[model samples]
Target: MIGEELEVLYEVDSTNEFLKRNYRSFHDGAVVVAIKQTAGKGRFGRTWYSPEGGLWYSVLFKPKVHIGLHVYTKIFSVSIAEVLKKLKVKVTIKWPNDIYYEGKKLAGILAEAISENNRVVAIVVGVGINVNNNIPDELKDIGISLSQILKKKVKITYLLDEINKYAWHLLVTYRNEPENITKLWKKYLYPKEGAQIKFKHEGEVLEGTILKISDEAMYIDVGGKVHVVQSIHELVE
Candidate 1:
Protein backbone atom coordinates (compact mmCIF):
# COMPACT_ATOMS: atom_id res chain seq x y z
CA MET A 1 0.00 0.00 0.00
CA ILE A 2 2.71 2.44 0.98
CA GLY A 3 4.75 1.46 -2.06
CA GLU A 4 1.99 2.34 -4.51
CA GLU A 5 2.54 5.26 -6.88
CA LEU A 6 0.16 7.85 -8.30
CA GLU A 7 0.49 9.95 -11.45
CA VAL A 8 -1.85 12.93 -11.36
CA LEU A 9 -2.87 14.86 -14.45
CA TYR A 10 -4.85 18.05 -14.89
CA GLU A 11 -6.46 16.79 -18.09
CA VAL A 12 -6.16 13.64 -20.15
CA ASP A 13 -7.93 11.85 -22.93
CA SER A 14 -8.38 8.88 -20.61
CA THR A 15 -6.34 7.62 -17.70
CA ASN A 16 -6.78 4.09 -18.90
CA GLU A 17 -5.25 4.97 -22.23
CA PHE A 18 -2.38 6.85 -20.62
CA LEU A 19 -1.35 3.93 -18.41
CA LYS A 20 -1.99 1.31 -21.07
CA ARG A 21 0.37 3.14 -23.39
CA ASN A 22 3.17 2.77 -20.86
CA TYR A 23 2.21 -0.51 -19.27
CA ARG A 24 5.52 -2.16 -20.01
CA SER A 25 7.50 0.51 -18.22
CA PHE A 26 5.66 0.70 -14.90
CA HIS A 27 5.30 -1.65 -11.99
CA ASP A 28 2.08 -2.90 -10.56
CA GLY A 29 -0.10 -0.75 -8.24
CA ALA A 30 0.70 2.39 -10.22
CA VAL A 31 -2.36 4.59 -10.65
CA VAL A 32 -3.38 7.52 -12.83
CA VAL A 33 -5.81 10.11 -11.44
CA ALA A 34 -7.18 12.68 -13.86
CA ILE A 35 -9.06 15.88 -13.13
CA LYS A 36 -10.83 15.86 -16.47
CA GLN A 37 -11.22 13.22 -19.14
CA THR A 38 -11.74 14.56 -22.66
CA ALA A 39 -12.30 11.26 -24.43
CA GLY A 40 -13.56 9.08 -21.62
CA LYS A 41 -15.57 6.03 -22.50
CA GLY A 42 -17.32 3.04 -20.99
CA ARG A 43 -17.85 -0.45 -22.33
CA PHE A 44 -18.80 -0.81 -26.01
CA GLY A 45 -17.53 2.64 -26.98
CA ARG A 46 -20.16 4.50 -24.97
CA THR A 47 -19.17 8.09 -24.27
CA TRP A 48 -18.37 8.88 -20.62
CA TYR A 49 -19.07 12.57 -19.90
CA SER A 50 -16.35 13.04 -17.31
CA PRO A 51 -16.33 16.86 -17.19
CA GLU A 52 -14.82 17.91 -13.82
CA GLY A 53 -15.48 17.50 -10.08
CA GLY A 54 -15.77 13.75 -10.49
CA LEU A 55 -13.46 10.87 -9.73
CA TRP A 56 -11.73 10.02 -13.01
CA TYR A 57 -9.02 7.55 -12.25
CA SER A 58 -7.61 4.22 -13.35
CA VAL A 59 -5.35 1.70 -11.66
CA LEU A 60 -2.56 -0.11 -13.46
CA PHE A 61 -2.23 -3.69 -12.29
CA LYS A 62 0.06 -6.52 -13.26
CA PRO A 63 -1.49 -9.46 -11.55
CA LYS A 64 0.23 -12.77 -10.93
CA VAL A 65 -2.84 -14.73 -11.90
CA HIS A 66 -4.11 -15.64 -15.36
CA ILE A 67 -7.81 -15.39 -14.62
CA GLY A 68 -10.22 -14.31 -17.29
CA LEU A 69 -10.46 -10.57 -17.95
CA HIS A 70 -13.95 -10.15 -16.55
CA VAL A 71 -12.97 -11.09 -13.01
CA TYR A 72 -10.97 -7.91 -12.69
CA THR A 73 -14.05 -5.86 -13.45
CA LYS A 74 -15.85 -7.50 -10.56
CA ILE A 75 -12.91 -6.74 -8.32
CA PHE A 76 -13.11 -3.09 -9.28
CA SER A 77 -16.82 -2.83 -8.56
CA VAL A 78 -16.42 -4.50 -5.20
CA SER A 79 -13.49 -2.28 -4.37
CA ILE A 80 -15.48 0.81 -5.14
CA ALA A 81 -18.39 -0.37 -3.04
CA GLU A 82 -16.12 -1.00 -0.08
CA VAL A 83 -14.62 2.42 -0.43
CA LEU A 84 -18.00 4.11 -0.49
CA LYS A 85 -19.20 2.10 2.46
CA LYS A 86 -16.29 3.40 4.53
CA LEU A 87 -17.22 6.95 3.61
CA LYS A 88 -20.69 6.39 5.11
CA VAL A 89 -22.25 6.53 1.67
CA LYS A 90 -24.75 3.80 1.03
CA VAL A 91 -23.54 2.21 -2.21
CA THR A 92 -24.21 -0.96 -4.15
CA ILE A 93 -22.86 -2.45 -7.35
CA LYS A 94 -24.89 -3.47 -10.36
CA TRP A 95 -23.63 -6.39 -12.30
CA PRO A 96 -20.62 -5.81 -14.54
CA ASN A 97 -19.43 -2.34 -13.45
CA ASP A 98 -22.01 0.09 -12.12
CA ILE A 99 -22.28 1.48 -8.58
CA TYR A 100 -25.77 2.32 -7.46
CA TYR A 101 -27.62 4.29 -4.84
CA GLU A 102 -31.37 3.78 -4.44
CA GLY A 103 -31.39 2.03 -7.82
CA LYS A 104 -29.77 4.95 -9.66
CA LYS A 105 -26.25 4.83 -11.04
CA LEU A 106 -23.72 6.63 -8.83
CA ALA A 107 -20.57 5.39 -10.50
CA GLY A 108 -19.36 3.32 -13.44
CA ILE A 109 -16.23 1.35 -14.22
CA LEU A 110 -14.37 0.31 -17.37
CA ALA A 111 -11.72 -2.39 -17.36
CA GLU A 112 -9.22 -2.84 -20.17
CA ALA A 113 -6.48 -5.43 -20.34
CA ILE A 114 -3.54 -6.23 -22.58
CA SER A 115 -2.41 -9.82 -22.86
CA GLU A 116 0.58 -11.59 -24.27
CA ASN A 117 0.84 -15.32 -24.93
CA ASN A 118 -2.68 -15.79 -23.67
CA ARG A 119 -1.80 -14.22 -20.32
CA VAL A 120 -2.67 -10.77 -19.15
CA VAL A 121 0.30 -8.42 -19.05
CA ALA A 122 -1.53 -5.53 -17.43
CA ILE A 123 -5.03 -4.42 -16.54
CA VAL A 124 -6.37 -0.88 -16.29
CA VAL A 125 -9.49 -0.37 -14.20
CA GLY A 126 -11.00 3.03 -14.89
CA VAL A 127 -13.63 4.35 -12.50
CA GLY A 128 -15.84 7.45 -12.73
CA ILE A 129 -18.03 8.63 -9.91
CA ASN A 130 -20.41 11.57 -9.84
CA VAL A 131 -19.22 13.50 -6.82
CA ASN A 132 -19.29 17.18 -5.82
CA ASN A 133 -20.86 18.20 -9.13
CA ASN A 134 -24.20 19.17 -10.53
CA ILE A 135 -25.97 16.51 -12.54
CA PRO A 136 -26.67 17.46 -16.12
CA ASP A 137 -30.29 17.65 -17.26
CA GLU A 138 -30.02 14.58 -19.44
CA LEU A 139 -28.31 12.56 -16.71
CA LYS A 140 -30.68 13.63 -13.95
CA ASP A 141 -33.12 10.83 -14.69
CA ILE A 142 -30.51 8.10 -14.95
CA GLY A 143 -27.83 9.21 -12.50
CA ILE A 144 -27.37 10.53 -8.95
CA SER A 145 -24.34 12.03 -7.26
CA LEU A 146 -23.32 12.16 -3.58
CA SER A 147 -24.15 15.84 -3.42
CA GLN A 148 -27.56 15.36 -4.96
CA ILE A 149 -28.42 12.46 -2.74
CA LEU A 150 -27.14 14.12 0.43
CA LYS A 151 -28.44 17.59 -0.42
CA LYS A 152 -25.00 19.16 -0.07
CA LYS A 153 -21.59 19.25 -1.66
CA VAL A 154 -19.33 16.32 -0.77
CA LYS A 155 -15.55 16.62 -0.77
CA ILE A 156 -14.00 14.89 -3.75
CA THR A 157 -10.63 14.56 -1.99
CA TYR A 158 -12.17 12.58 0.86
CA LEU A 159 -13.86 10.25 -1.59
CA LEU A 160 -10.58 9.79 -3.42
CA ASP A 161 -8.85 8.89 -0.19
CA GLU A 162 -11.49 6.30 0.59
CA ILE A 163 -11.10 4.80 -2.84
CA ASN A 164 -7.33 4.64 -2.57
CA LYS A 165 -7.41 2.94 0.82
CA TYR A 166 -9.98 0.32 -0.12
CA ALA A 167 -8.33 -0.39 -3.45
CA TRP A 168 -5.08 -1.25 -1.75
CA HIS A 169 -6.85 -3.46 0.76
CA LEU A 170 -8.65 -5.29 -2.03
CA LEU A 171 -5.42 -5.76 -3.94
CA VAL A 172 -3.85 -7.64 -1.05
CA THR A 173 -6.97 -9.66 -0.34
CA TYR A 174 -7.37 -10.59 -4.01
CA ARG A 175 -4.00 -12.34 -4.03
CA ASN A 176 -5.44 -14.88 -1.60
CA GLU A 177 -9.01 -15.38 -2.83
CA PRO A 178 -10.22 -13.71 -6.00
CA GLU A 179 -13.70 -15.11 -5.68
CA ASN A 180 -14.04 -13.60 -2.21
CA ILE A 181 -14.19 -10.21 -3.86
CA THR A 182 -16.91 -11.49 -6.15
CA LYS A 183 -18.89 -12.69 -3.15
CA LEU A 184 -18.92 -9.15 -1.74
CA TRP A 185 -19.88 -7.94 -5.21
CA LYS A 186 -22.93 -10.19 -5.22
CA LYS A 187 -24.07 -8.87 -1.86
CA TYR A 188 -24.40 -5.24 -3.03
CA LEU A 189 -25.63 -5.92 -6.56
CA TYR A 190 -28.87 -4.14 -7.43
CA PRO A 191 -32.03 -6.07 -8.28
CA LYS A 192 -31.34 -7.71 -4.90
CA GLU A 193 -33.47 -10.84 -5.33
CA GLY A 194 -36.48 -11.66 -7.46
CA ALA A 195 -36.28 -8.23 -9.08
CA GLN A 196 -37.08 -8.03 -12.78
CA ILE A 197 -34.40 -6.55 -15.02
CA LYS A 198 -34.12 -6.12 -18.77
CA PHE A 199 -30.88 -7.17 -20.37
CA LYS A 200 -29.24 -7.39 -23.77
CA HIS A 201 -26.75 -10.00 -24.92
CA GLU A 202 -25.40 -11.43 -28.15
CA GLY A 203 -27.34 -8.85 -30.20
CA GLU A 204 -30.64 -9.92 -28.67
CA VAL A 205 -32.79 -8.25 -26.02
CA LEU A 206 -34.23 -10.22 -23.12
CA GLU A 207 -35.38 -10.18 -19.50
CA GLY A 208 -33.74 -12.21 -16.78
CA THR A 209 -33.46 -13.13 -13.13
CA ILE A 210 -29.89 -12.62 -11.94
CA LEU A 211 -29.28 -16.22 -10.90
CA LYS A 212 -25.66 -15.84 -9.87
CA ILE A 213 -22.15 -14.85 -10.89
CA SER A 214 -20.50 -17.63 -12.83
CA ASP A 215 -17.23 -17.76 -14.71
CA GLU A 216 -16.63 -14.02 -14.83
CA ALA A 217 -20.18 -13.04 -15.84
CA MET A 218 -23.73 -12.95 -14.61
CA TYR A 219 -25.68 -16.16 -15.00
CA ILE A 220 -29.08 -14.68 -15.73
CA ASP A 221 -32.15 -16.87 -15.81
CA VAL A 222 -34.66 -15.27 -18.14
CA GLY A 223 -38.14 -16.67 -18.53
CA GLY A 224 -36.81 -19.97 -17.26
CA LYS A 225 -33.99 -19.46 -19.76
CA VAL A 226 -30.32 -18.97 -18.90
CA HIS A 227 -27.82 -16.59 -20.46
CA VAL A 228 -24.31 -15.36 -19.70
CA VAL A 229 -23.21 -11.77 -20.08
CA GLN A 230 -19.62 -10.64 -20.05
CA SER A 231 -20.53 -6.97 -20.00
CA ILE A 232 -23.65 -5.13 -18.86
CA HIS A 233 -23.19 -2.06 -20.99
CA GLU A 234 -26.84 -1.88 -22.03
CA LEU A 235 -29.73 -2.40 -19.64
CA VAL A 236 -33.14 -1.82 -21.14
CA GLU A 237 -36.32 -0.66 -19.49
Candidate 2:
Protein backbone atom coordinates (compact mmCIF):
# COMPACT_ATOMS: atom_id res chain seq x y z
CA MET A 1 0.00 0.00 0.00
CA ILE A 2 3.05 2.24 -0.19
CA GLY A 3 2.88 4.92 -2.85
CA GLU A 4 -0.15 3.44 -4.51
CA GLU A 5 -0.55 6.84 -6.14
CA LEU A 6 0.40 5.36 -9.46
CA GLU A 7 1.11 7.75 -12.31
CA VAL A 8 0.47 5.27 -15.08
CA LEU A 9 1.73 6.21 -18.52
CA TYR A 10 1.60 4.85 -22.04
CA GLU A 11 5.22 5.40 -22.97
CA VAL A 12 8.38 7.11 -21.87
CA ASP A 13 12.08 6.83 -22.52
CA SER A 14 12.67 5.92 -18.92
CA THR A 15 10.52 6.00 -15.80
CA ASN A 16 13.57 6.90 -13.76
CA GLU A 17 14.17 9.87 -16.01
CA PHE A 18 10.64 11.07 -15.50
CA LEU A 19 10.96 10.90 -11.74
CA LYS A 20 14.36 12.55 -11.76
CA ARG A 21 13.11 15.44 -13.87
CA ASN A 22 9.85 16.02 -12.02
CA TYR A 23 10.10 14.66 -8.46
CA ARG A 24 12.34 17.35 -7.02
CA SER A 25 9.38 19.14 -5.46
CA PHE A 26 7.31 16.05 -4.75
CA HIS A 27 7.06 13.88 -1.70
CA ASP A 28 8.95 10.68 -1.10
CA GLY A 29 7.22 7.38 -2.00
CA ALA A 30 5.74 8.77 -5.18
CA VAL A 31 5.58 6.19 -7.95
CA VAL A 32 5.71 6.36 -11.74
CA VAL A 33 4.72 3.34 -13.83
CA ALA A 34 5.04 3.11 -17.56
CA ILE A 35 3.77 0.75 -20.22
CA LYS A 36 6.57 1.13 -22.69
CA GLN A 37 10.00 2.69 -22.55
CA THR A 38 11.70 3.63 -25.76
CA ALA A 39 15.11 3.74 -24.18
CA GLY A 40 14.99 1.56 -21.08
CA LYS A 41 18.42 0.99 -19.67
CA GLY A 42 19.98 -1.62 -17.42
CA ARG A 43 23.01 -1.41 -15.19
CA PHE A 44 26.24 -0.19 -16.86
CA GLY A 45 24.30 1.56 -19.67
CA ARG A 46 23.14 -1.61 -21.33
CA THR A 47 19.90 -1.37 -23.31
CA TRP A 48 16.79 -2.92 -21.74
CA TYR A 49 13.78 -4.17 -23.65
CA SER A 50 10.65 -2.54 -22.32
CA PRO A 51 8.36 -2.68 -25.30
CA GLU A 52 5.12 -3.63 -23.56
CA GLY A 53 3.46 -6.35 -21.53
CA GLY A 54 5.93 -5.76 -18.72
CA LEU A 55 6.17 -3.80 -15.51
CA TRP A 56 8.26 -0.63 -15.89
CA TYR A 57 8.19 1.57 -12.86
CA SER A 58 10.24 3.69 -10.49
CA VAL A 59 9.81 4.58 -6.83
CA LEU A 60 11.15 7.82 -5.38
CA PHE A 61 12.92 7.95 -2.07
CA LYS A 62 14.96 10.27 0.10
CA PRO A 63 16.86 7.83 2.22
CA LYS A 64 17.69 8.38 5.87
CA VAL A 65 21.25 7.24 5.23
CA HIS A 66 23.41 8.68 2.50
CA ILE A 67 25.20 5.47 1.64
CA GLY A 68 27.43 4.86 -1.37
CA LEU A 69 25.90 4.14 -4.76
CA HIS A 70 27.02 0.53 -4.64
CA VAL A 71 25.24 -0.16 -1.36
CA TYR A 72 22.10 1.48 -2.63
CA THR A 73 22.18 -0.73 -5.70
CA LYS A 74 22.33 -3.78 -3.48
CA ILE A 75 19.33 -2.52 -1.57
CA PHE A 76 17.44 -2.10 -4.81
CA SER A 77 18.20 -5.66 -5.84
CA VAL A 78 17.20 -7.00 -2.48
CA SER A 79 13.89 -5.20 -2.67
CA ILE A 80 13.15 -6.77 -6.04
CA ALA A 81 13.98 -10.21 -4.72
CA GLU A 82 11.65 -9.75 -1.80
CA VAL A 83 8.70 -8.86 -4.02
CA LEU A 84 9.31 -11.65 -6.53
CA LYS A 85 9.41 -14.25 -3.79
CA LYS A 86 6.00 -13.15 -2.55
CA LEU A 87 4.46 -13.69 -5.97
CA LYS A 88 5.32 -17.40 -5.82
CA VAL A 89 8.07 -16.89 -8.34
CA LYS A 90 11.42 -18.54 -7.96
CA VAL A 91 13.87 -15.65 -8.28
CA THR A 92 17.45 -14.88 -7.34
CA ILE A 93 19.83 -11.98 -7.23
CA LYS A 94 22.55 -11.80 -9.86
CA TRP A 95 24.62 -9.24 -7.99
CA PRO A 96 24.73 -5.47 -8.52
CA ASN A 97 21.10 -5.52 -9.80
CA ASP A 98 19.43 -8.27 -11.74
CA ILE A 99 16.70 -10.78 -10.83
CA TYR A 100 17.06 -14.11 -12.46
CA TYR A 101 14.67 -17.03 -12.97
CA GLU A 102 15.92 -20.47 -13.93
CA GLY A 103 19.33 -19.12 -14.91
CA LYS A 104 17.91 -16.33 -17.14
CA LYS A 105 17.25 -12.73 -16.32
CA LEU A 106 13.63 -12.04 -15.40
CA ALA A 107 13.97 -8.54 -14.05
CA GLY A 108 16.59 -5.79 -13.83
CA ILE A 109 16.97 -2.71 -11.63
CA LEU A 110 18.44 0.72 -12.29
CA ALA A 111 18.93 3.19 -9.46
CA GLU A 112 19.42 6.91 -10.08
CA ALA A 113 20.07 9.35 -7.27
CA ILE A 114 20.76 13.06 -6.89
CA SER A 115 23.11 14.12 -4.17
CA GLU A 116 24.23 17.59 -3.18
CA ASN A 117 26.80 18.56 -0.57
CA ASN A 118 27.31 14.82 0.10
CA ARG A 119 23.67 14.49 1.08
CA VAL A 120 21.13 12.51 -0.85
CA VAL A 121 18.32 14.54 -2.35
CA ALA A 122 16.41 11.94 -4.27
CA ILE A 123 16.66 8.32 -5.38
CA VAL A 124 14.63 6.67 -8.12
CA VAL A 125 14.73 2.88 -8.12
CA GLY A 126 13.69 1.73 -11.57
CA VAL A 127 12.46 -1.83 -12.04
CA GLY A 128 11.61 -3.61 -15.26
CA ILE A 129 10.06 -7.07 -15.10
CA ASN A 130 8.99 -9.10 -18.08
CA VAL A 131 5.46 -10.16 -17.30
CA ASN A 132 3.42 -11.20 -20.32
CA ASN A 133 5.57 -10.62 -23.34
CA ASN A 134 6.70 -13.31 -25.69
CA ILE A 135 10.42 -13.84 -25.48
CA PRO A 136 12.11 -12.19 -28.39
CA ASP A 137 14.53 -14.31 -30.37
CA GLU A 138 17.50 -12.12 -29.63
CA LEU A 139 16.96 -12.52 -25.90
CA LYS A 140 15.51 -16.02 -25.73
CA ASP A 141 18.83 -17.51 -24.85
CA ILE A 142 19.55 -15.04 -22.07
CA GLY A 143 16.16 -13.91 -20.83
CA ILE A 144 12.96 -15.52 -19.53
CA SER A 145 9.73 -14.05 -18.28
CA LEU A 146 7.06 -15.27 -15.87
CA SER A 147 4.41 -15.59 -18.57
CA GLN A 148 6.77 -17.44 -20.87
CA ILE A 149 7.91 -19.93 -18.31
CA LEU A 150 4.54 -20.54 -16.74
CA LYS A 151 2.62 -20.64 -20.01
CA LYS A 152 0.05 -18.30 -18.59
CA LYS A 153 -0.73 -14.65 -19.09
CA VAL A 154 0.61 -12.57 -16.23
CA LYS A 155 -1.26 -9.48 -15.20
CA ILE A 156 0.57 -6.23 -14.81
CA THR A 157 -1.74 -5.20 -11.97
CA TYR A 158 -0.84 -8.26 -9.91
CA LEU A 159 2.85 -7.58 -10.31
CA LEU A 160 2.44 -3.92 -9.50
CA ASP A 161 0.40 -4.69 -6.39
CA GLU A 162 3.08 -7.01 -5.06
CA ILE A 163 5.70 -4.40 -5.84
CA ASN A 164 3.84 -1.74 -3.91
CA LYS A 165 3.45 -3.93 -0.85
CA TYR A 166 7.00 -5.27 -0.83
CA ALA A 167 8.55 -1.88 -1.54
CA TRP A 168 6.85 -0.36 1.45
CA HIS A 169 7.93 -3.25 3.63
CA LEU A 170 11.54 -2.96 2.52
CA LEU A 171 11.68 0.81 3.01
CA VAL A 172 10.32 0.52 6.50
CA THR A 173 12.54 -2.42 7.40
CA TYR A 174 15.63 -0.79 5.90
CA ARG A 175 15.58 1.85 8.60
CA ASN A 176 15.04 -0.49 11.56
CA GLU A 177 16.63 -3.75 10.35
CA PRO A 178 18.95 -3.30 7.41
CA GLU A 179 20.57 -6.64 8.11
CA ASN A 180 17.34 -8.41 7.21
CA ILE A 181 17.69 -7.13 3.67
CA THR A 182 21.13 -8.67 3.31
CA LYS A 183 19.94 -11.94 4.79
CA LEU A 184 17.09 -12.27 2.32
CA TRP A 185 19.42 -11.44 -0.57
CA LYS A 186 21.73 -14.25 0.45
CA LYS A 187 18.85 -16.69 0.59
CA TYR A 188 18.21 -16.54 -3.14
CA LEU A 189 21.36 -16.14 -5.20
CA TYR A 190 21.55 -17.23 -8.81
CA PRO A 191 23.87 -20.08 -9.65
CA LYS A 192 24.24 -20.80 -5.96
CA GLU A 193 26.91 -23.43 -6.50
CA GLY A 194 28.51 -25.94 -8.83
CA ALA A 195 28.04 -23.64 -11.80
CA GLN A 196 30.80 -22.16 -13.92
CA ILE A 197 30.51 -18.49 -14.73
CA LYS A 198 32.58 -16.17 -16.87
CA PHE A 199 33.49 -12.79 -15.47
CA LYS A 200 35.29 -9.71 -16.74
CA HIS A 201 36.88 -7.75 -13.98
CA GLU A 202 39.72 -5.21 -14.22
CA GLY A 203 39.89 -5.80 -17.99
CA GLU A 204 40.51 -9.51 -17.80
CA VAL A 205 38.36 -12.54 -18.61
CA LEU A 206 38.22 -15.28 -15.99
CA GLU A 207 36.18 -18.40 -15.50
CA GLY A 208 35.28 -19.58 -12.06
CA THR A 209 33.06 -21.86 -10.01
CA ILE A 210 30.40 -20.41 -7.81
CA LEU A 211 31.15 -21.60 -4.31
CA LYS A 212 28.69 -19.68 -2.16
CA ILE A 213 26.63 -16.51 -1.93
CA SER A 214 26.62 -14.35 1.17
CA ASP A 215 25.60 -10.98 2.55
CA GLU A 216 28.56 -9.04 1.15
CA ALA A 217 28.65 -10.72 -2.26
CA MET A 218 29.34 -13.97 -4.04
CA TYR A 219 32.23 -16.27 -3.34
CA ILE A 220 33.66 -17.45 -6.64
CA ASP A 221 36.61 -19.83 -6.83
CA VAL A 222 38.70 -19.10 -9.88
CA GLY A 223 41.67 -21.42 -10.34
CA GLY A 224 42.00 -21.89 -6.59
CA LYS A 225 41.78 -18.12 -6.17
CA VAL A 226 38.54 -16.91 -4.61
CA HIS A 227 36.99 -13.60 -5.60
CA VAL A 228 34.05 -11.97 -3.89
CA VAL A 229 32.06 -9.94 -6.40
CA GLN A 230 29.40 -7.40 -5.58
CA SER A 231 28.73 -5.84 -8.96
CA ILE A 232 26.53 -7.46 -11.58
CA HIS A 233 28.27 -5.72 -14.48
CA GLU A 234 31.51 -7.50 -13.61
CA LEU A 235 29.89 -10.78 -14.70
CA VAL A 236 29.89 -11.42 -18.48
CA GLU A 237 27.97 -14.69 -18.71
Q: Which runs in model 2 stand beyond 4 Å of their true positions?
A: 64-79, 192-237
Candidate 2 C-alpha lDDT tens digits along 1-237: 456466888999899888888887557777888889998988667889988888888888776765445444566676667766666776777764788888788988788788779867888888888888767999999899888877889778877776667667765667556566656656665655678988886889889998976544667899899997876667786
lDDT of 1 by residue, 1-237 (tens): 512787789999998889888877778877788899999878788888887888888877787775555666776777778777766778877766788888678888888888789867888888898887667999888888887877778787677667767767766767568678767767887755566677887788888887775545667788787777676565665
Once fitted onto the true fold, the runs of candidate 1 whose alpha carbons sit more than 4 angstroms away are 198-208, 215-217, 227-234
Per-model TM-score, in order, reads 0.85, 0.82
Query: In candidate 2, which residue pairs clash?
Result: none
Each candidate: what lDDT? 0.76, 0.76
Worst 10-residue lDDT window for candidate 2 reads 66-75
lDDT of 1: 0.76
